[model samples]
Target chain A: MKGSSPLVRPGAPGRAGGPDTTRQAGHRATGTGSRRAARSERLAPYVLVAPAVLIILGLRLYPLILGVNFSFTGDGDRNGMVVGLDNYLELADDPLFRTALGNVGLLVLLLPVAVAIPGLLATFIYLRVPGHRVFRSVYFFPAVLSPVIVGSIFNLMLAFDGPLNTVLGTIGIGPVDWLGDPGVTMFTVVGVHVWATFGMALVVFLAGFSTLDSSLLDAAQMDGASLARTIWHVVIPSLSRTIAFVLVTTMIGMLTSMFGLLYVMTSGGPEGSTYLPEYYIWIQQGQMNRPALASAASTVLFLIMLVVGLAQVGLLRRAGRQD
Target chain B: MKQRTLWSAVLVAGLTVSGCGSATRTAPSPAGSGTSSKLVVWDWKSGDATAASYIEKAKADFAKKHPDVTVEFVAQPFDQYYTLLGTAIQSSTGPDVMLFNGGGQLRDRVDALLPIDEYVAEDRQRLAGWDAFSKDGKVYAAPVTLQGHPIYYNKEVYEKAGLDPAKPPATWDELMTDCAAVKKAGKSCFALGNKEGFGIQFFLSGLGSGVLTPQEYDDWIAGKRDWTSPHVKQIFTLWKDVNDKGYNNPGANSTAMFNDSWAIFQSGKAANVIGLMSDIGHWKDFGEFLPPDKIGVMPAPVVTDGATPSLAYDGGIGYGVAKWTKDPKLAADLVRSLTSTEALTAFYAKAGAIASDTTIDASQSGPAAGAIVSAIKGGKPALHVALSSKTLDLMGRVSQKLLSGSLTVDKAMDQMAAADKAS
Candidate 1:
């Protein structure tokens, strides 16, 4: 194995230099000076990443550690105290925490539907259809608005005497209780969430579509591939990375970004139907005066993100290996 | 040497900025030289506008008297006012005298407020219900207005439903019967939107106090009694009964207090509304749906066989002196001025709310204000504000669950007990 290493070293010099004196010079340089070069080269990756590493450690990791430490305590009265794992133990019996978990699961299941509709909508715009820019701008307008603004607008629109009911009246359809009914409140919030976020997903898919080689699409068309077939077989495979990226981001956004909408719209009510874990954490901290419970809830949220992120990283790594 | 020069230049720049800040410390008032150091007074009531004009008059009057004190009046939107005040007071940079919501939350921040015992003692009888403004016998706030939540009904709806327009419901059964009739006549009878839950508490507690004694209420608040008791269960059952009877708007659970359900009542789609004293000024516009003679006011209903009917009473806003204010006496003067009968009378004229002072007779108030005062004075006891914070949250949650069919009265009561225990 030691003798064969010399042959492997020759491949690098042979590729870089012509097979004469240049090759000898390359070999000489590698044999003599490569050790020092390799040491710096190995450290170069870490040197480039140092700032980001420090930032993550300082901002993200430190807070996460502090939150976990707080979660173990029964510090509901004071800001914090050390009780040692009692908070996590309490979670086993916490009905609200369980409800929050179930709601988060529901949110996760609905996220793909939320992401896909916008993804396809953007794909249509990317195909250069008539009034595509106008369509894109209109579809993306809600994304530009703050969640509070969007929520308030939806609250007005869904109100009993709102314009929506007026339109329903014109159609001779009875009014649907969009926000009042517990069963429908989640769906209404989900609708608002999709409206508010789908634009960013659309734009991402459009960018992904733009990066695809047009010749491959042309080849697929020459082979009599239908649009659906082209999308499923070629386009989707080419955009798998983008799809993965959008999926992870959409999940994270849904888990964390619904607080403003929940606050302004239903306030997680008509019986906590629209209550997500994030809003629950806020309620625990602000209303319940249970910062320890909130910290525990936050720790659970952190674990969820960590698991989901690690899984995504693993999947991406496998995909890369396959490629 | 170059590094030292660079450091010296940076130091000089910092010194220049700091020097400029110090130079402006003694700057004259922007309003003018005659204008004294501006004393800001913050409040959230619409009456603030009338109060502003009153303050302008007071400023001229006070200037003629003192000639050195200047007052600047600042009013903020009601929703943002408390948060802005809280933050400002915490930072030691709030208005000299500002309005605070009178309740436990303000009581929690006692350290941030200056005790107004001296101010109260100077004119004790002029300040009505001084006990309510006192914390441990030391007054921290001066009450400005008395907000009584009265049940106002559209007389046209009553007449259309074949009920007497002159005689409004005085008992729970009468109210329910009239409501059923109103609903049958193709209009929502009562506008009870519990989506915010505060409105629910207002309605329930208003009626509940008539049935549940003050002792029972105290027992509930103190965790000695469960909500499943007949008295407490009646409140929840009444909510369910009203909802089941379709007396309320169909979308009330989703409707916000100020936005949908209340707006419906205002538009005459709903016949009856529980309105605040402040809402009396808007009655003229609300009465456009019904003739002025067809609108009538009454206290919130009492249960059958109950001794007294009750209305929810929110002690409107109170003026407080910030603890860190440079001029406590000036702040106290501002508070005293705002709460004075002259200023309050002008406020009452504009807003149609009763002045807090008992010396300002109800007979002198407008018809609407008199009605509000009568309803409040007739009330048994306001149950909602009397409950502890923990019990209030329990009530809000249990009421929500009961309405949604997720909790029965017994289960809700148990949950309330559990919540009390947990707290």
Candidate 2:
């Protein structure tokens, strides 16, 4: 989305303040009689921005520093002691923490699948596939439910003797241990997380579609472009910015917000294969009473999010520009 | 309550002054207990419907002695109770009195609790689980209820399998044969749930008495455990073997013990379940689904010759005075009232808690209760309770691995031993 200019847009045509008109106004406003007015006007933007700047510093930046500081300390008998890097050392030694990091890597690899599911659905809806109106509402219904509710409902449906398996068994397929198998649990949890969150991304795509050039679609149809070719040549290039935004937010959501699903669905168990950094931090801080170690995990998780997110946005931007 | 608080303040103050206090910073309030007269109590049970009458009775008991003091009970969700308490302790701002589970859970945080030994001295003979609430000979909490794992069999299931419910199996081989019969009858032998890895804990402790010899049982609790011992290894082997043999309900790994596993046994989907003796998941609970007569207590079948089967029990839930309390004596008095004979009797009657007060009558509940009550006299501490929180957590994960075939019993035992040693 592009930022809107209510008052001044520098190079746009027929705006209230043209560049030539602004120069004449600036000369009159800075004259001897209006010097005080000009000075205060110069300070207005900073005045408008002060509250948000202060809030971000206090709530956001301060906590990050506090957490990083805590990560260096010790827990339990050594509470409040500066046993530098001891907590981080212990975090490294923990197999569960390693599993959490591995899970993060897995999520990164699966990021495109998560993005594509909603992207493809929105595309179909935009093209007005049969029952598209009903499909749009129905497909997005699960996303309205909280992750806790989604996880619980899935708990029943994905059980060994659950409905999903019962359906599979009719065709002699399986009674898969969906949440218990180490190999399957992570995917199951990620799938549920996406199931419960895809609607938000779908809404974003729909809004992007509203701004899409419909004439291009008609022109493509007038030519001989296939549906796949049309999407690749026309739709993809036009919606690149929205896709980039969705990718960053979805990756962030997967890394930080899957804690609830992991907690409710598996408790990071079935051999801790479903462990994510957020869940691991919770176990360390909450269950194990090792606040320092939890802080260390939190720091690592934050770094992981930062590095992955920035790289993704930059890559997306370069891709968008090239297109 | 005021007078007792003054006495306790002086006593604890003297200890701190002499530099022998367990926690020195939580000094008595200078304005006295008057400023902090509103005594807040935190627990996970007060919100539970079954425990409502019990909390009310305890509150009434406390009110009689200190009507001037206001008592506020905060019911915390059980899953997040410890984490919330940990946060409060870190901030040095929390309830005056709080509930604690016994053994490693209490032992781990005993430093944050005021020793109520002197305050609770009068009730020593009445309560039986002091060891669980005590650390290094100093009692930090007063026991309110006893929790134990007791193997409960469905008499109807046994009868349907053509085995006389009156004459249940008494040995491992007999149990296996009976399980085969039950299996053939289209019901799993056990309704096991290991979702939280708690099923394995229940399995180990419930059957441990019949797996370990008398000397081995006592030795394990005394910090002389031999995890590599064949008998110890057998417990894990049975855990793996039973699941492998299809003796448990399907999806045991995903099924929760609190309700799902119990539901199977309640609906007669399984023959037996290693159930608890207090709170939820007990005889009282199972009785609600199946007729009380159908729910029968059975000691674990003898796994090895000379292995004595006994009930595995310990202090279930207890109330402790927080170090930050304005009135340790007042909080301790509340603990005493919570565990008082009259209060506990109401608790046992209404909530089906095996009240810490032994004087509370148990016969009225039923035959299963009678058997459990009789067995309590000979019961030993549960095998799992001896484990530290860290070790128990490791065991939970490894036990899951064992079930999933990723890990072997011997390797699991080695990991458990390593965690135990680190603890």
Candidate 3:
């Protein structure tokens, strides 16, 4: 620990050879020592990158490639045999799968709403509103909960004769079928998911807010600029990268991680109206026992995620440039 | 340092995002069964308190035959049972023996099982409803419990509605009239939960006998299903009609059938429910909520004028040997022991199953059990149970849509017919 400090510090000497043999700077720069030094310098980048590169190849890229390959196979009687897109052909004809894809489109349309909720809250917190610390903790508590717990809590609240209906009835509003109606179940599930997860995005936005320049806000207030104008002209341009990160993460969260909520809340029910690709893959692979067909659905989901992620990055970068 | 931390964070997040990938997982390698000391069994029952004694009895029975062989029972959660089984099937190596629900679920996965007809020849006459676990006349699993759809009436609701519980409806018109009276008294006639699509299966099997002509009932079970038949269409029509007429509890489309629909009946919110004969949502569960006398089991009311009503039942659950087992004879022996009279008797006594063993003393189980046992003699294989898993799955969604008035009965029936033909 004593001598190695200089070894890691850039431009530091004393990282030569055995003990005091080549510790002398004049000896280290001669013949074979210089060649070894050059070689180690060349190897530094690879050493730094090894862990992250191996993790991505092993965990992310490998499973994705494996999933796409498996989509060509057959299930049941034809277990291991490759059928070459028979599963995709079947998915095209299936209405339930189509509904799942349609729900993905619905999620895309609601992306802005999900991002804005947390973005606005972060701003309020950044402004140091009354009891901000307490509000931050209370708002972020739901994000710490597992979706199963959240979904179960919402399931009790959203029952037909549950407290929500009772409260609505007291206010002279007609009882809305939160989960029983085919058209309403998907929205109810998505609303619960957003409620449960927005805190994560809120925390991220707060971190971005911490890095914001205080002088710009002070000048805006002095100039009699409205809160909306300040956020639009200053905060938006400064935090574009953070907003982009939140948008991509939130979209991915909706697509991949809402399975637990969908599973518990509506179970893609009220006549299969809430079938997301993630849940559709579950049904095909688990309930329907069509693992091969599930793979095809998964491959399509992967492609959708790729397109959506790239679009987000592109859109955010362009907006940042314009600013 | 910041760049490295960011890369680590991004990679960790990437790894955490997962979905149900269709890629088959590597299955546990097959355990050599010939002279092997261990035999593992997979089921959703062994962990259940009531089913524990049954498992013990079954293991003892098997132990008598193979004194040195040991047994292992792995109980899976009921909800995730099939998915786990599907995973095991794909890998070609799982448990030496497994439990299966009787119908299309068993039929669809027969390739993974060893047909035990030769091993169980002696027990054939004692047990009933073997057809439910068979495909093309070859038995895939032995019947342990008889599951059926019986009309269980809440006599408290009937009495409250100013009707005699003793005289449950004898015809469709009478049932509707009673439902109207119940509604007038601020109660629903039926407690239906179609959320998982199982409510429709119970409905189809429960009321189908009263709707289809006796010939059509036999034909439907015999693989000669006539989707275009008016009587068949009437089953789906009556399903929607009851819900539309406010005969069922509100939110029937959203309610889950597992115990929620049964809860409505138990709480006396409904007059009757087309419920299971075994396991749950039966006389035993309802007996706890209502007095024993108030829990009445009645035959389905007549829907079609000329139709002869009969109890609709089949093998409920059974034990099957895996195809990869090294010793077929030993695994089959284990299946036989699992369904043995002594084992099934303990199952019935503690679990309240209407055991497949016809000789079991069910007289002590009360009048409701007696009625179900007597009905089994005339009962046909359930109409819904006869359909393949694919068809049953399709029927559930279609039935839900039919209840919501999104799809017509004819259109649903057409889809079911197409699925049936393909399967």
Candidate 4:
């Protein structure tokens, strides 16, 4: 009865009366199998994410490295040959590129306004203002539209002879060349960009509002706090992280995502006053056959975004700590 | 033919698969070594509704010559055509034949193209505007359409201004007087759009003949441009003067030269526009809004003494075989079919282009087209076309600045001279 039992199998490792050679072989096999299982368990996370990591490396990082390398090479007759900072020197001398960089600075200065409109709108919605549901949907509507469509629609609305000017004329106000004035065109484009994209930021803010401890807002109200005071004291601190996220994102959007609008409306014109780095890169690479110069411009843009993003994060963290 | 069709199916399948990969990963065999049954072409026009019949006629002509060979025309967006072509060139894989704008666009990328002069020798006598598609006496592409800047005036506006519509201005003074009358009639003297900087191109070329001595005009086209010359400065100064005197449509800096400026002229808001002989801003397009007889074509008014006015035209667009093609002869044959008289006549009829084929009858298009045709013999290469792409681009920007009063003509002339010299 003992020999027929499963536990009494002769070759099982660590059995009380097993033979030495067979038992030793079984013990080694068990050790090897357990070690293999442990190693496989250790590798599971990486194995699960291998495809994604590979994809990111191949598609994003590899091309980025290639592009940075390409920036140092020559274009046209000297193509594929290393030129050692010649493209960067050329970019420095280009007035159009300089205008583009200046526009980037303008965008950075305007970032707070871009973030605040949505924050305020989300606060109003969260407060259950009149027709809050309708306002939420209405505000989010523009975000769903393609930039090309928005740009085209605005082009019609903002032209010198367009409906906007006509309305201004009826109001006894002088008509303004919204898209024509070099001094005003970049502001006009940024204004439109803010309008179109503020919806997405508002949604992010509303989500942040959902996580906010409503008790603090209620406490402020109970203390006879004014709406402005409550927002400045309680709500701003509560949504500090959200504001930081929105600020960095909005800045990135302005720097990178204005190409479609720029392409459709003004085309970086009015004496190159509306030029952005992306549009400048496109013009150099596509129109002027200076891909290396475009690459240099692109690298500069990337560096600007990096520095600005890191600075914003550091500033926001310090502000949050003070709060 | 069935085998050719099967081969076409395979080629399409191959292209579809290859298109999914990076251009470098799927480099196709050159036409000289690959199967000759299928030829791929890239153009901005083939997809246009107007170019349908022209494409069909050309396809039929090509089919007659190589009945066993299949042709695939890939229509690309004009805005991104050159960019995409550059990518293909860098990867060493693309269409067998591609379309190019005749001047700087073609010249800037000649290394990617095969010279078709030997193949198109038979076409020399028949085609006009060959010089535009030629560089250093070697033709790279076959001319398809003739493009020129023609001053188009609205007869109705001229009549409203109490001027003879039949007789347009013949000198700078006459133009100014006509413009004054137009302003009095509450209409703009010119429909101008400098948004994309193309308005300046039309302006310089349209009025160049009027301001420059005939010798200077020829010299400029012959690559001896003197950007600092007094006549050159006058063109920029007069451009600013027109805007300063309220002779152009308001917000000239914002309006696009394409349909926007054309719309101003068509809507009777402006008396005249320096327009094109072919493409969107031509007499045919203007005729769409105004009656054909209401549009009048006139030479540029003389702005300087000893200046002789004539049309400024060149090859508008053309098709060339790529150097990497396995069968240059077959691709060149496709180019020939694309430029054939029958196909061009269809193109002219359907697309309203001034066909590059000189023998094609254009009298039926309109009197404006007729006038353009008559002036062809005296026409010269466009002044702006003579400048390098860099200079042309700078000129466009400065022209906008000049109109905005942010830049001076002297400063613009200096910048232009420097850019030209650099090129």
Candidate 5:
């Protein structure tokens, strides 16, 4: 009936059509509206990401760039003229820098073993072992105390006339100078570092364990899998992500957090045996008036962290793929 | 999503705004007019009870003199003092006057200090030891206090150890013999805590002055003289001798100077303390421990066999007006007033400090002050102030190593030579 009504008018050769033109205009309007909507949709994710990107650029990237630039320049005195890689070259030959790097390397190598003990404890607790709650809390208590307090307390405990020596005397063992001897100083510092930090790692491990699939565990148990086998094949693999996170973060913390302990306990002495990179940096910048050297050392540290981080990311991605 | 975007924008804006605000706040600005009502002073040591009284008196006196001005005193703790001073000076929020120790540390910060030579020139005769204030021919700090480290012993402990209480050691050999007697008496001979490594300096400097000529000492400091030479070896040997003889506290290597040594000496478990200006008052309860008459003060024993050269360690504390101070003239005036004889005498009497002014009558000093004055006048260098901080810190570590038996005299001397060369 509508077609019959419209059929009365036929257009001349050059005249414009009505219904067809109307349909085309409607399509154009709808296309423009959809394009606007699509543009906003594309922008929404970027708008969400912009603040984070800006923050990273400001706090991390900018300081890193500035540090790198300052490292190549002369010491920040009135005569702080740019000297182009002199500081880095000096760092290459610097004995103190070598010592600092060696100490930091030692810390990194020792940290994983140190952290594993706490990780095992957490795993035990996560499996609902007897008295798990009390054990977990007991293990995690150290993490709540500040490093300075821990260091001071340890200083008193390990002092020459303190309880440690008294215990040794009673055991018919000779007195040992825990902090004074070069051989024992690093071990002392590392022991304190592990004690102060292991709790946080345990907490992370527990959190990771809670997310594991109980169904998989039960299935493994039904198949007559042993406890060790279930942990090895099921639990550890599930918590690989968390383990990587803790490993990198703890390594960074160990490199930096020794300052408070060293300052409180040794002041980097009994012959600079406990001097780490951060403490060395403090001496350079604050005590020695050698900020250029400190900056150079800082640059080396940045590079080390960068390499370690990249390696960690690569390993984690490969592990993720395997999973 | 729109609400999230708005909130995120607000957060970013907040951070940026705060950052800008702090940046602006931290930047330096020019001084206000002289007619300003308030004056600020920063001091670390002078905030102690005795020093506070003197400061209060000075404030009252200054206020009475200048009715238009109000004085404010801020005492920063020793640990945070330098940091706050550095930041404040850099930002021009510094006090009109600041207390400083005259040493290499002060020399390093010489650029931050305002030269007071002009003020001193106007009141030249009023100053004492004018050279103490000068750095690079410009007086930047005004001397306030003189310090010295003397060996103080418990006379009863000496008598108990079969050494004469009235006659302290006159030579290094005699001192060693006395130390042995004290040790044999089942008492700690000396309170030598190397944790802070300050005790090491006192020992080294005392020995070094006796053994090395002034020229030789200068050459050694300048790295021109070999630290592996006989003089250096002798100094370390003396240290080793003392350590090996059980003269020092048994656990000296691990003992903290501030915490452990004070307790040891106060408890009369130790015979002697090579104590600074502060240690005299530490024995305020002298009657309970040793009786007032039993506390004997003498020069740190000399190494030279004959009459002991009047050897002592003199450390000076002073005031410097920050370069960034808004009121330079007022700061200079404050420094002048603080260093004046009238001000210093009162400060010394009140604070138990040895007067830095050589012109001041030593007879006028209290018993403790008299000892410090005599020590300084007799030609002693405050080894802590004489050597650079790095050198001092190295000495500290080496001394610890020496006590621990990890570093022999030969090895320590070699290390010192190497360190001196490096520095």
Candidate 6:
């Protein structure tokens, strides 16, 4: 040990010893190098993931926590002062907020129709319907257009004295107040939203269709099954996971993505019947200068989404197990 | 070792960006640490084709005072202006100067605004609509234009209906008779758009003077409102009655007060509208469609016997200095330049704003503008402007319900009363 030089390589001639001493030195040096390499290998994964973790912490989780904390603070004269559940209490008492929550329920009820339209279209396309290529593009076209453009287009078409009403008149039917009737405005907006977004879901369904077991369909066909029966027996069972994914994603889209349409189409009008929680949050923060109250509404919305998402996953898993 | 160093550098870079994003910026020095080479101004009007000359004139005026300082005017969309301003206020980092609507909008965000009273004192006598931008006896902004709700009518429609276009309705009965004739002539009596719940405010302020007695009107403006008063009830009742009687254009609830209601009037589909005096939907906008001679500004027809109608006016818009500005004096000077006579006159001539500068000549702005100018001396603050932002919003929603027959007048009044009281 005393005679060995620091710069001496394991294989290089060193000291009076020949190949035996050199081989022993080589193993000693190699052991230290391997230990260092192993340490680097262990840390590589953490280094790779560090940026994404920082981004999520900085952009998402931090703001979410800040918003929840801000919800407890006061606005205006009492700004920055904690007011406990005062903002939440105010949200509960507000009729417009109540209406917003009620509309969320309505959107939930309409979620099945929204998912099915896309699922059906995707199926047709997957089955190689005539002009399928064109249909695929045409269906997805609206998805590319901004909600503002769609809302503006629909406003002209759905106006009381608009072309749709004129067509109804020619057909000997009375005009329907598509956007003006409180009872019908929410439905009209939802219908437009579905029309605008179904293409996206359709694409997802088609992607799901790609992985479908062709043999199952062929077996159903051999059993003399009708188209609908075959679809129910073969395609649906095979695409259960896809169906679950669509259901969860579609619900989330309805809850979050309808803001632009609501803003342009109704502005939560016809007696605030079309107010969604997101719109309500905008009104509170933007219009009414009640950011604290808006944050409370946001927290409530987050909880609602969390509960809805969890329940959906639980149900889908149970159904999968039964199947 | 090199790979580990590179990865470490990448991690440091990523964290650095995130740290900058999450860090709270230090408040800008109130005394202006040093004179900023540039000043940023935010307004919805600066981008308009009509307001281009006005903006140029304002910039020129600003340049005269500080040739070295550059002023950047950011024309935000009016829909998102307040929301953006609120975000700016929260972050304590926004334009040095920003535009604000009169009354509740200015009042609510006074915490973020620098009081420019001393800076704007010289322009006080020249400008007309100061009360609207003042909160708690302190001025947060300088008035740029006098916004008023003037009942504008199409003279050509009157001619087609065989009614005297010159002699517009002066009482409730005459208005009803005229509306009947207009209806028979296949034209709507009013071009109303309540989609944003804004139409109700215009309607309330435009027609309020005709229903409430002068004393009651004064009391209401002074915050001594009686929402259950017979006159107040009549205002809401008349709104419903007018809609029920087929006076407003069909689907009024769905119609937007913005370019839509304005469009309805412009296209000659409706005879009359409660139009603005500043910004859009004014005599200038109407003049663009109808012949200048065909646009008429009529006083509100008396709805009650004791009622004495007067114009409802307020500060339409004004620019205020932000509290976070590096240089308050510089920002205030910029605001003053924005409202200078040369700038406001250009604004009036091009944008057709009823310039808040009282001495701005209105002779070339056509007869309707002339009438508006004449009525300003007797104009009262807008009734809607007297209410809090929350109440005004609630009134908008309830007004739609009242028009749709979902809520009775009594029920609507109760809601308004509660909202007014709470706000």
Each candidate: what lDDT? 0.69, 0.83, 0.84, 0.86, 0.70, 0.86
**lDDT by residue for model 4 over A1-323, one digit each (tens)?**
22233433332334323334544777876666655654555555567667877866765566667778999999988999999999999999988999999998899899989999999999999999999999999999999999999999999999889999999999999989999899999999999999999999999999999999999988999999999999999999888888888887898788768999999998998888999888998788767888888888878877777787779779778766765
Instruction: List model 6 lDDT by residue over A49-98, tens digit each.
Output: 67987876765676678779999999988999999999999888988899
| Residue pairs with backbone overlap in model 2 | none
lDDT of 4 by residue, B195-255 (tens): 8999999999999899999999999988898888889889988999999999999988889
In terms of lDDT, the poorest run of 10 residues in model 3 chain A is A11-20
Candidates ranked by DockQ: 4, 6, 3, 2, 1, 5
- Tens-place lDDT per residue, model 2, B1-423, is 112222433454454343322222233344454544677788898887877877788889998998877788878778757756766676666678889999878888887899888999899987877888999889999998899999999999999999999888889899999999999999999999888889989999999999999999999988999999999999999999999998989888888776789989999999999988888888888888888878889998999899999999999999999997877788888988888888788778778778887776687687788788878778899999898778888888998888888999989999999999988
What is the lDDT, from 0 to 100, of the residue B67 in candidate 2? 88
**Candidate 3 C-alpha lDDT tens digits along B1-423:** 112323543564443221112212222224654554667788899999999899999999999999978888878778867766766676666688889988878888898988889999999999998988998889989999999999889888999999998899999999999999999999999999888889899998999999999988999888999999998898888999999998999888888787788999999999999998888889887878787777888888998888888999999998888998867898899999998999999999899789999888777777778888888888899888778777877888898899888998889988988999998
TM-score of chain A of each: 0.77, 0.82, 0.79, 0.83, 0.76, 0.82
Pairs in clash, predicted candidate 1 = none
Interface RMSD values, listed in order for every candidate: 12.8, 12.8, 7.0, 12.0, 10.0, 11.0
Model 5 lDDT per residue over B1-423, tens place: 112222444565465455444433533344454564666677786668777656765666676656777666767778756756665655555576778876665776777788888776766554434444566678878777755566678887888999888888877778878888898899988887788677787676545666665666656534466676676677778888777977788777778877677667767788988666532433332334555566777665666444335444443688888786666777677676676666666666666556666566645433434555656656555444556666777888888878878777787777666665555
Alpha carbon lDDT at A281, candidate 5 = 69
| TM-scores for candidates 1 onward, in order | 0.77, 0.86, 0.85, 0.88, 0.81, 0.86
Best by lDDT: 4
User: What fraction of the native alpha-carbon contacts across the interface, defined at 8 angstroms, is recovered by model 2?
Assistant: 0.49
- Candidate 3: stretches off by over 4 Å: A1-60, A77-81, A124-134, A210-241, A315-323, B1-40, B64-69, B74-96, B322-330
Lowest lDDT block of 10, candidate 3 chain B: B18-27
User: What DockQ would candidate 2 receive versus the native complex?
Assistant: 0.29
* TM-score winner between candidates 3 and 4: 4
